[model samples]
Target: MIEIRGLTKSFHKHKVLDQIDLTIRKGDIVAVIGSSGAGKSTLLRSINLLEVPDAGTIRLDQLQVDFARKTKADVLELRKSTAMVFQQFNLFRQKTALENVMEGLIVVRKVPKEEARKIAARHLAGVGLSDRMHHYPKQLSGGQQQRVGIARALAMQPKILLFDEPTSALDPELVGEVLDTIRKAAEAGNTMLLVSHEMSFVRKVATRVLFLDQGVIVEDGTPEEVFSRPKSERTKQFLANYYRDQEPEFTI
Candidate 1:
């Protein structure tokens, strides 16, 4: 379980997060939804200590993460249990798909070279990229490269995966493949915290949903409760505009 209490962050004099408290159970897929700059990305980074919090505590299982008291060593250890995937697929341009996935296992985790390669192969296959293992990031399509990114994260065997707008950079036709892969992972019991603009995908995959506005989570509940019956007017208004372009039309 992950528990966050009184979490707060600021940039210079501007606050990006304020007194945020949330709990994520093991094997749960929680989607964080909000407009741009609403602190969704910042919140995920704070949990992994990538973005230091000015105040508050983050607890993962029995491990306590106090950003205020954290050292370089402490942050490194915390990151091993939590891995992040960015919207842009950050793979090495010079490396093959398999090598890109194995980079972390060999460098940070210090696994043996041969063993890491085997593990990398398995994960690449898991993401449906077995044949593309020899391909470089530039050689593959956007969706394929993102799958490589996912494989790289999976090879780390993190307890929690944080996705910051995973499909935001993909073309419309490519989005479904990445989302499908994520859906399969969630079904197979991978704990995840996702920051996304895709409402329909969130509605289908998330067990719980968080609605944030102005650096605070205004609504938090099951997908059905939050999306279909939001308690706040801000949430309702946001959803109305968000789904406006996607709503179907009928002709008499």
Candidate 2:
């Protein structure tokens, strides 16, 4: 289980996160949904220390870090338990898909080079990128590169996988493939926390959903509850606009 307590953050004197308390049970696929500037990305990033919290305590199983007093070693230890996939497909342009996935394993984890290769290959294949393993990021489609990013994170076997708008950078036609890859990962029982605008996908795969407004999680419940019976007015307004253009799975 992952426990986060009293998490808070500010940017240039503007608070981006309030004192947030969240608990994620194992195998929970939690999806955070909110309008832009609702602090969705910040919340996900803070978990892996990508955006350090002003005050918080995060415990991932046996590992714990108090942001107020955490050292570099504590930061690294916390990071070791989680892996993040960014929206922009942050792969190395100079490396092949396989190499990008193997870099962390062989360098950070100190796995043998041959062993890293095998592991990377398996994950790349898992994301349906086996044929593109040797292709560089520039050579692959946006969706393919994102899959490589996913594969790299999967190769870490971290206790939790963090996704920050993983499909936002993709073209509309390419979104489904990346979402499919994530669904497959979920089926494999990888605990995940994601910030996404894909309402339909979130409703379909998320075991739990959070609605954030003004840096606070105002609603948290099963997908059915949040989408169909949201208790917060802000959540209702947000989903109304979101589903206005499509066939809504959510009742505004």
Candidate 3:
């Protein structure tokens, strides 16, 4: 399990995240949804220490770190337990899909080259990229590149996977492929925290959904509850605007 307590972050005196506390149990696929600038990405980034919390305690299983006083080693140890798949599919331009997946294993995890190659190839194939494994990121479509990003994260086998708007950069036609790959990962029981605007996908996959607004989680519950009977006015208003342009799976 992962526990966060009093997580707070500020940028030039403006608070981006404020005194947030949450817990993610094993095998829980938690989806965070909110309007733009609602701190969803910040929340995910903070858990992985990409955006260090100004004040907080993050506990991953038996490991804990106090962000206010954590040393570099503490930071590294925390990072080892989490991996992030970004929206932009941040693969090295010059590296092939297999090399991108292997990079972390070979460099950070200190796995032998041959072993890393085998593991990377397996994960690339898991994301349906076996034939494209030898292709560079630029040569792959958006969906394919994002699948590689997912593969690289899965290869890490971290305690929890973090996805920050993983489908936002994909074209509408390409979105489903990446979403399908993520769904497969979820079914395989990888603990995940996803920030996404794909409400249909969120409703289908999330064990729990959180509605974050202005640096706070305003609503938290099952997809059926939050999407159907949201208690917070802010959540209702947000979802109203969100579903106006698209068909919501649940009545808003």
Candidate 4:
């Protein structure tokens, strides 16, 4: 389980997150939705200690994050428990898909190279990239590269997975394939915290949804509740523009 309390973060003099509190149970798929600059991505990164919270407590299972006394070792351990996947596929150019996935296990976890290869192959297959294991990032399409990224995270066996706009960088036609891979991961009961603009995907997979505006959570509820009958005016306006292009008219 992941628990966060009194989370706050700032950049220079500008506040990006303000006294945020949330709890995510194991195997829950929680989606954070908002307009640009709403601090959704910052909040996800903060959970993994990628962005230090100015004041907050983050606990993942037995591990605790002390933002006040955050050390390099603390950050490393937190990162191991929480793997992050970005919008841009950040695969090493020189490494093959399999090698890319195996890198963390071999380097960080100190697994034997052979054992890491086996694990990497299994994760790649899980993401439907087994056939492309030998391909380099440059040789694969955008969606395939993102699949390798997913495999790399899975190879770490993280307790929590954080996705920051995973499909934002993909072509429209390729977005479905990447989201489909994530849907499978969700079905497998991984604890996921996703920052995404894909409302349909959120509606389909999120056990809970958070709507943020101006660095604070304005709405928090089950996906059905938030999407169908939002309580806050901020949330209603946000969804109004968000579902503007969709058919059937988003309504309660």
Candidate 5:
């Protein structure tokens, strides 16, 4: 389980997150949805400390960290518990798909080269990239590259998987493949926190939904609950605008 309380962040004088509180049960696939600059990405990034918050307490299972007074070891422990799959498919330009996945095990986890190779190959295959394992990022399609990124994150065996607009940087045609990979991860019972603009997929894959506006999570519930009967007017407006071209219901 994960618990966060009084989570806050600011840049210059602008508060991006304001005393946010949230919880995620183990194996829950929670999707964070909102318009631009709604603290969606920042929330995911903050859990792993990519964008450090000014104040908060983040608890993952038995581990907890106070952002206001986190030690270096605390930061490292927090980072170790979560792995992020970024929007841009952050792979090593110089490495092949297998190498990209293996690097973390070999470098950070201190696994032997041969052992890391085996582990990486298994994860690559899990993401349906076995044939592309030897290919460099430049040689793979955007979707395939992102799959490799998924494999890399999965191989770490972190407590939670954080996805920050994993398909936003991909071509429209390629988005499905990455989303499929994430679906497979969910099927395999991996806990995940995702920030996505793909509302349709969010409804399909997410067990829970969070709608953030300004700096707060205005609505939180099952996908069906939030999408079908949002209590907050802002959430209803956002969804209505998103699915304006479709049916009155959230078919898309």
Candidate 6:
């Protein structure tokens, strides 16, 4: 299980997160939904020490870290236990898809070249990129490139996976492929925390949903609960605005 308490971050005196607390069970796919600048991405980044929160305690299973007093080793251990996929596919321009996926394994994990190659190839195929393995990032479509990012994260075999608007950069036609890959990972029982604006996708794939607004999680429950019977006015307004074009029920 993953537990977060008193998570707080500020930027030039502007509080982006305020004492955020939540728990994610093992193998759960929890989607964080909110407006822009709602602290969703910061929360995910904080988990891996990317944003360096001003105050918080992060506990992943038995390992724990206090953000205020985290050591270098603690940061390293936190990163080793989690992997993040960004909104933009951050593959190296100089590397092929296969190399991009294998880079972490060979460099960070220090796996033998042959072993890393095999592991990378398997994950690339898992994301339906076996045919694009030898292609450079520039040669792949946005969806294909993001799939490589997913393959790279999965190849790490981290205890938890964090996705920050994974499909936000893709075109409408390309979004489905990346979402499908995430769904496959969810089916395979990967623990995931996702920040996404795709309500339909979240309703379909997320085991739990969090509605964050203005630096706080206003609602947390099963997808059905939050989407169907949200208890917070902020959540209701957000969802209503997000799904204004849909049916009155917003039952995607």
lDDT of 5 by residue, 1-252 (tens): 999999999988999999999989999999999999999999999999989999999898888899999999998888888899999998999999999999989988899999999999999999898899899999999999999999999999999999999999999999999999999999999999999999999999999999999899999999999999999989999999887856665446
Clashing residue pairs in candidate 6 are none
lDDT of 6 by residue, 125-209 (tens): 9999889999999999999999999999999998899999999999999999999999999999999999998999999999999
After superposition, the stretches of candidate 2 with alpha carbons farther than 4 Å from their true spots are 248-252
Residue ranges of candidate 4 with Cα displaced over 4 Å: 248-252
Reference-based TM-score, model 5 = 0.96
Q: What is the C-alpha lDDT of each candidate?
A: 0.92, 0.95, 0.94, 0.92, 0.94, 0.94
List TM-scores for all candidates, in order. Answer: 0.97, 0.97, 0.97, 0.96, 0.96, 0.96
Task: Residues 158-207, candidate 3: write the lDDT tens digits.
Answer: 99999999999999999999999999999999999999999999999999
Q: How high a TM-score does candidate 6 get?
A: 0.96
- Mind giving the per-residue lDDT tens digits that candidate 4 earns over 56-109? 888888888778887898889899898988899899999999999999999999
Model 1 alpha-carbon drift over 4 Å, by segment: none
lDDT of 2 by residue, 1-252 (tens): 999999999999889999999999999999999989989999999998889999999998888899999999988888888999999999999999999999999988999999999999999999998899989999999999999999999999999999999999999999999999999999999999989999999999999999988889999999999999999888899988877878756787
Please give the lDDT score at residue 238 for candidate 2. 90
TM-score-best of 3 and 4: 3
